[model samples]
Target: MPAHDPQATPADELSQARRLLNRVFGYDDFRHHQGEIISTLLAGGDALVLMPTGGGKSLCYQLPALLREGVGVVVSPLIALMQDQVDALRQLGLRAAFLNSTLDAETVHATEQALLRGELDLLYVAPERLLGERMLSLLERARIALFAIDEAHCVSQWGHDFRREYQQLSVLHQRFPAVPRIALTATADQRTRQEIIDQLQLQEAAVFVNSFDRPNIRYTISDAPNPRERLWRFLEQEHPRDAGIVYCLSRKKVESVAEWLTARGREALPYHAGLSDGLRRHHQQRFLREEGLIVVATIAFGMGIDKPDVRFVAHLNLPKSLEAYYQETGRAGRDGLPADAWLAYGLQDVITLRQMTQDTDATEDFKRSAHQKLEAMLGLCELTSCRRQALLAYFGETLEAPCGNCDNCLQPPQTWDATEAARKALSCVYRSGQRFGVNYVIELLTGKDDERIRRNGHHRLSTFGIGRELNAVEWRVLFRQLLAQGYLDTDLEGHGTLRLTARARLLLRGEIELHLRRLRRPERGARERRGRTVLALGEAEQALFEALRSRRRALAEAQGVPPYIIFHDSTLAEMAQRRPTSLGEMAGIPGIGETKLNRFGKAFIEVIREHPG
Candidate 1:
């Protein structure tokens, strides 16, 4: 078999890839851009793919690696992700292995020997390991199919998850000039895309940009007070018994939130850079293997987690940039089911993020870029229109109509002309000597007779009692909106004191009319659990699904792998609904490839046969 099939027509090559897909992965059709990407690589051409999470980006390279003569080298970032991918491929009975720090010397040498003998269909390596001289030498002795750079956006300085090691991956191109290279990521704006191309030296690679819209995800952002309670309400209402991730901006918050949730009768774990590596791994493993587990974490937790049933991703604080927000939120609903991206941010989140960005030791240009990204994120949170439209537009995609899925679309927020309110708010900030935080300023505005106000002489100010019409909650909402809209800025040096911006000058001078979202009380009544029933199975089917899950869990525990490695929930749902009692019938299911049919088909068939319904 030739490493490069130069004479095969595009039609023939695609036909072969499709056959391999069905036989190995048990999928009948190609998703959005998988076929085009696979064909690009199969024809000995480089590709730069930008497909959304769960859009079948893996198949683009995985299928081609199997069809080609030599092993496909995949550059991955996370050890857990590589392990999961390899385990999944092995479950399908494919020749897959990973070389990472987790493996001992004996296993690493055996994996290298297998590669030299052309025994691996796919090999996943970290960028740091792949750039090493020893690994480069080993690859030179083996037949090469192609190179895949997963999470390719990490090479860009502008991206949220930038890794300096990824920038050195151009060495793959420099060394293996003949072997095709494919760089792929789920999130990257136009600037990051160009940077990836330049840094990875893939300017000539075919660029395939799929739609960044994850319609299954319903985005909701709230500035409600008592965010801990808001998060509890959200979890109780929607994801009471589902696996999810809750993100915090600080490691301390991660630990505290996890402890709080655990005390509240929910099993939550903490994950951050501060935790010991063993503990982090243990928490991550528990989150993956168990159902209805929530992992409260900082940005360190999720980057290439392959768990498919994450029903929600909640953020208790503001993320640094829109790219980070989009990337983090994209982790939910990777299985293409209805999921949620919920956020509970406050004025203090804004102040803290601004201070952190300013205090960073990065270059001024990078700081400016970070500020711009932060502003975009604030804009998305403050959007009264379709959030999906604005989010897609940030990635240079267009949604002509409202999605009707996001919170803004489902429960349209009413906007009020706040020209007078804005002028009074700005005046209050200025009249307070620009030295007090939101609480003090709001107290002064609402005519609260406090000793601190008297000592500060704010009681005699003209703006002290002007905001008496609105209550404290309403005023806080207005002030948060003011900060989000850039009409008010936080004094980092003054302990988050509110100060007016140039933008606020126009509003106070009567040059512009300001309209803001009216602060509505959090919805009252019995909350309905929406989008939780992913399978939507009948009672009998639900019982059978549980039985199937039990069997999968047993098998996974025996093998020391996550249950999804054996079979995803969707695959089991199909089995439960179809109740395929025979091995032949089970093979007709979507995820049961030839290898899996031969491996575990009879066990699942026995379960289906024993099911009462």
Candidate 2:
């Protein structure tokens, strides 16, 4: 080993980070990868940071821009991101500006002049803006200190948000050979990571991969008959009167859902590309400014948004890929507070996602890549193990036990022998000439005498009536398991045909044993009963928690914001558990700070003492 540097210490590193934090945004500590990533950039090295949302990635670049001598050029993909960051920097008294298509020519010219005058510390520009020869020459003329790429995963073809303009970002190094570069993204798998590095030409960059684990988030996947009903129930019970985003797969679904909520007397809005830009901006602003505003949208929303108090994010359909799923779910619980990350999954979600993936006209490599991602997401949905552990493992991390937060961890499921069900489903698919959809095959297997079944004569097949032991719902569940287990494949070209794979043959021949888990169905009565019983808490603790929440609500009202904006539900739960008696003890809670302690410390102590232990 080389000789150690006796002069360097962890204290020195921390002190440097604290100073930078205070100087730039008036903070005192780093969140997630902000410290290491900033240090790497300041040392004149490139970095690849894979942090979750609410992990303070902007600070990684902002602090380095303040520490460096010249201006830091930030290449962002969204104009809204530029405006938000610029406004926030101005609030902090930092000289920052942006150049984008949204700006008028005069404003753009003024921004360039400020850059050349060395009056601005950081300048944000879109990738397309940076590609212009005029902008390139302006950058060359300015004293460049650093080059930062935000949302760098967009450079990869495998990324869900791939943009062709991102391919030109590599020119930054050739044009400004001495500027330190850093590529940042909240979500990227191993494949996308390599593509980002290659496309950005950061071969020699120091990699600072942070943990993708969001332990504060609780992941739950529910298999219900009516997904929409289940989603409404979940929202009403867990996160009533909170701001959230619900993602539907199509624009039509977005509109209908938003209208449905509106009819039900909820303050919800529809958002998608089909709407006018003015309408989209209006809905986006309402969601940000108003509490309990639900925005139902397609995947076009929620990129680089600074909303930290999003209490939940629901997916009405499966996302395009696991990376997309991760990135979208990351929009929740960004303040290191407890938040719910939920998905109402079913058989149709799998079919819809797979069909969408196959319908795209891409190279064979891209199709196979997408297929692998879908398989991973499918496994996540159908997993009988811990959801948090499975999610973390996909990102190259390990969790040895249940996280004690998710649904599965709270109420474990039972496994059964699925080998027979798998065989019957596969047999029905094969006997039906692999030409029918899941519903038809399911009816055939259950020996239903429906018109379509008799018209197709599927009831006369050898596999028909063999599966009469199970009901229609049971057969549907079995088919979903078969799809998740790879025993069957859906033919996307023929209106989502159910086809048996080779694995199905082995099951039929008794050469392979398939194991399936028994899924629990929440009946209306049972769900209603569960809903009536509020969150489980002791009498004293419940009182204290309620009191703390009341105080939180008062403070939030005083500030004209939502209660969650002050402290998340998870933080309240922690306070209830600790029953902190002093300011120091209260400040030691996860999200409580000195400012908040000064504001609400006495109230919290009074609440805790008013109840019996």
Q: Which candidate leads the pack in lDDT?
A: 1
lDDT of 1 by residue, 123-238 (tens): 99988899899999999999989999999989988778989999999999999999999999999998999999999999899999999999999999887789999899888888
Where is model 1 poorest over a 10-residue stretch in terms of lDDT? 1-10
Q: Candidate 1 at residue 536, lDDT?
A: 86
Model 2 ranges with Cα > 4 A deviation: 1-16, 23-26, 31-33, 523-613
lDDT of each: 0.89, 0.79
Q: Which segments of model 1 are wrong by more than 4 Å? A: 1-6, 492-494
Candidate 1 residue 463 Cα shift, in angstroms, is 1.2
Give lDDT: candidate 1, residue 484: 84
Question: Please, what is the TM-score per model?
Answer: 0.97, 0.85
